[model samples]
Target: MQVTIDKNSGYCFGVEFAIQMAEDELAHGGMLYCLGDIVHNRMEVERLNQKGLRVIDREQLELLHDCKVLIRAHGEPPETYALALRNNLELIDASCPVVLKLQNRVKHAFDLSQRQDGQIVIYGQPGHAEVAGLAGQTGNRALIVMTEADLDQVDFARPVTLFSQTTKSTAGFYKMKALMEARIAAAGGTLDSFDANDSICRQVSNREPQLAIFAAQHDVVLFVSGRKSSNGKALFSVVNAVNPRSYFIENEGELQDEWFAGAATVGICGATSTPLWLMRQVAEGVESMGELV
Candidate 1:
């Protein structure tokens, strides 16, 4: 049996930066608090937790008045930073540069739109950390559009500036944009669709095409990813669609021997948030199991 790993299957720049910041802080032996999971991957979070990184929520921040806190790569709202300052907490910001840029774009667009009697529309999941942060920039003026249906909440006659969460599906974003434009045109109203940024990180946007090729090259696929990662979920769908023999697992322990029972060639791939070391371990486990068989 042959085994292959996808070249792009591993931690993306954002997750890599966040994890490195956490590890650097932990190695110095100080009290470190992460505002959220450093990343969505449970294994990576647990590993950091073992190294003395404490994950805290808003309430926890309130209780611990004087402490050092690290903002996750997901990035929090300005109010969150304000609260940290009000509590006299030392801040260690680790927000991804891409997310930080999106936040700035949303804030700037919202500011300009508000002056011109326009609205800021965000294409993202409601209540998601990133969405919440972007919405906060608009002081709640930003409208969240998870689907074309959510467009009903906006005034079609007015001008709209659209932005998307960094991890949103590019295809879905374009479809929603086209639908909104169609609705406005049908209404015979003067609608200014200002900007539609494809804010999705390349780490995710590039995975679909790569997965399609990877799926075609292998007979059976072992996809490793944390269930909570949005990018992982998106990429997994692509892989499964292209290759029916694909299986998803969080780690080596979850790998079922039955998956390899009749397979001659295997391929291993993982999400952007997945660590390379973890994937290697899973591959090694698979190799060892194959030898026994």
Candidate 2:
């Protein structure tokens, strides 16, 4: 049996930057409070926790004072800063540059829409942290649409500016864009009248096609990812679509021997939120399983 790990799978630049900030703070020996899970991956979170990074919630944030709070790559709204200020807390902002730019763009569009009676439409998971941040820029008035059906909530009779979460699928974003455009056109609008931003990160957008091709080359594919990773679920769908013998597992314990019974080559891959060491750990498990096969 031959076992290989997808070279392209692991933490993207933003997540890497966030985790590195947490590590650096923890090494310096201070009370480091990460606003949320530093990354979606539990293994990486646990690793950081063991190294003295404490994850805190918004409610807990309000009660704390005079400590450093690290904002993860999922940027927070202006309200978070206000709250931090009231409590005299210092914010170690590690917000992704991509997300920060998107927030500013959304705020600007929202400001313009308010005057012209337009709407700010965001294509993302409704309650997602990143989406919440984007919406906060609009004073929480941006219409959140996770699917084409959610587009009905928008008033196409008025101007609409559309933006997307940084980690969402590029194809999915464009598909939603097309559907929204058609809806607006039917309501007597044109492409020139609507504003659409393809804001999905290039690093993530490029991986979908790469993963599909990688899955097709292997007899069996293992998709290693944390359960909370949206990109993991999206990229895994690409793999499953290209190869029927694909499995999603968080770690070695979830790997089943049946997945490799007749397979000569196994491919392992993971999401951008996944740590490289975790993928290497899965590769080691695959190596052991190959010996059994």
Q: Best by TM-score, which number? A: 2
Across residues 149-196, which tens digit of lDDT does each residue of candidate 1 receive? 799998877787888888777677788888888877877765455556
lDDT of 2 by residue, 1-293 (tens): 78888999898998999988888878889789989888889888898888889999989999999999999998999999999999999998999998998899999999998999999999888788899899999999999998877988988888889998888888789999999989988999877769999999889999999999999999999999999888888889899999999999998888888788878888999999988899889889888765544
Can you give the lDDT of residue 144 in candidate 2? Answer: 94
lDDT at 100 for candidate 2? 94
lDDT of 2 at 231: 85
Q: Which stretches of candidate 1 lie over 4 Å from their true place?
A: 291-293
Q: Give candidate 1's error at residue 219 in angstroms.
A: 1.4
Model 2 poorest 10 in a row by lDDT: 284-293
RMSD of each: 1.9, 1.2
